[model samples]
Target: MNKLTAVAVSVLLLSAAPAQAQSIPGWKAYRAQQTGQQAAPAANAGQAPAAPPQATDPQPAALPQPAYQTAAAPYATRPAPKPAPNGGLFVGVQGGSGWVYEDVDQRAVAVSAGYRWQAGDYSQVGIELGAGRLDETTWRDYGIPEVKFNTIGANARFNFGNSPWFGVARLGYWHARSRDGWDRKVTADGAYGSLGVGVDLGRHFNLQLMYTGYTYAVDSYYGDDEYDINRADTVTLGAEVRF
Candidate 1:
């Protein structure tokens, strides 16, 4: 009986030692699992989801502008003009009547032609020819008669610049033929001169007032004549034109 009890106690102690060893191994395994779980979470938190692949091409930057550029130009301007000069050629006509005091008082018609050359700014020289008829007349109670005369002359003119007026001196020669109702013919040669002043109207027309003088010689059946000079003075008012 005593041997049997000692054996039973040894068996019981052996069984308890095995159980404690088994428990230690199980506790170590549980702790390792918990530590592994904590480490996993920390690693996950630290590693950012692999940074989304960084872009290769970056966005473009803005460019700058230039400060010194050229501007446009401005406009231009202009000028003025001048004037003309004066002086040229001229021509025209004249008509009027005159008288011879004491010797013969007559009415006549005359046609004349002439040319003038300018001698200065206000002066001219010219020559003229004219002819006319005379009415019934007698000289010195000699029963002489009526005659017609032909005249030729030259003249010089002077003009006043401030006015349209001029002064003239004329020298001329004349020839006359007479008819006395007798069976004879008579003729005379003479010289004459005139002094005058005239006013010009526009466009080559002028009005004139003049004093005329005549000296003559006669040839007839009356006899050989000496100093057959006849003297006459007259006034003429006429108009003239220019070409």
Candidate 2:
């Protein structure tokens, strides 16, 4: 009986020892789980890795343009003036000295208006009307009368070239009358011609330098005996305006 009880107790103790060991965690099993290799998911385990995305050509972007450009032209050219269907109207002013040929020197100022039609590749034909004053004319043709003069004229002009630098020619008829300050009245009728050059300031403005010569027949001055002919010349600087 004693031997059987001891055997039974031994078996119970041995079974309890296994249960306690299972309840306690082992350090070696913990370390193995931390350091061990992991398995891949079952779904992708057999497939080859996806090939890297195939490269495609990139699109081009617009190139930058230069800010400056080169000119192939050797010379500068003038721009054409505006012309109307009927004709173009223009106005001008001139101021300079006028001398009665073989007589006295005088200061002069003139204003003019004109109409022009294009006549050629680079020239314009025009009719002009103008009026002006001369400051003094000390001598009559016979050197007897002291006078200042007023002048009125109708003219024809030819402007050559569409360039900034250009040439001009004019022919005109003039009438001159002595001003009231003079002691006696005098009158002269004449024809005049001029040659000039001009620069274009811009589209509507121009500057000019001119030389003009006049020849007159004295209709009468105080009395007919004073003179039969009168002559004068002037150099003028002026401006022309067009619309």
* Candidate 2 residue pairs in clash (backbone atoms < 3 Å): none
Q: What is the clash tally of candidate 1? A: 7
Q: Write the per-residue lDDT of candidate 2 for residues 88-174, one digit (tens) a residue.
A: 688999999888645467787888888777665556677888777776545555333323434344433444444466677778787
* After superposition, candidate 2 runs with Cα above 4 Å error: 1-87, 101-103, 137-162, 179-182, 219-227
Q: What tens digits encode model 1's per-residue C-alpha lDDT throughout 112-164?
A: 56777777667778787766654554556755355577788886778766467
Highest TM-score: give the candidate number: 2
Candidate 1: worst-modelled 10 consecutive residues by lDDT? 79-88
In TM-score terms, candidate 2 sits at: 0.54
Please report the candidate that would top lDDT against the real structure. Answer: 2
Worst lDDT 10-window in candidate 2: 142-151
Native-referenced Cα lDDT, model 2:
0.70
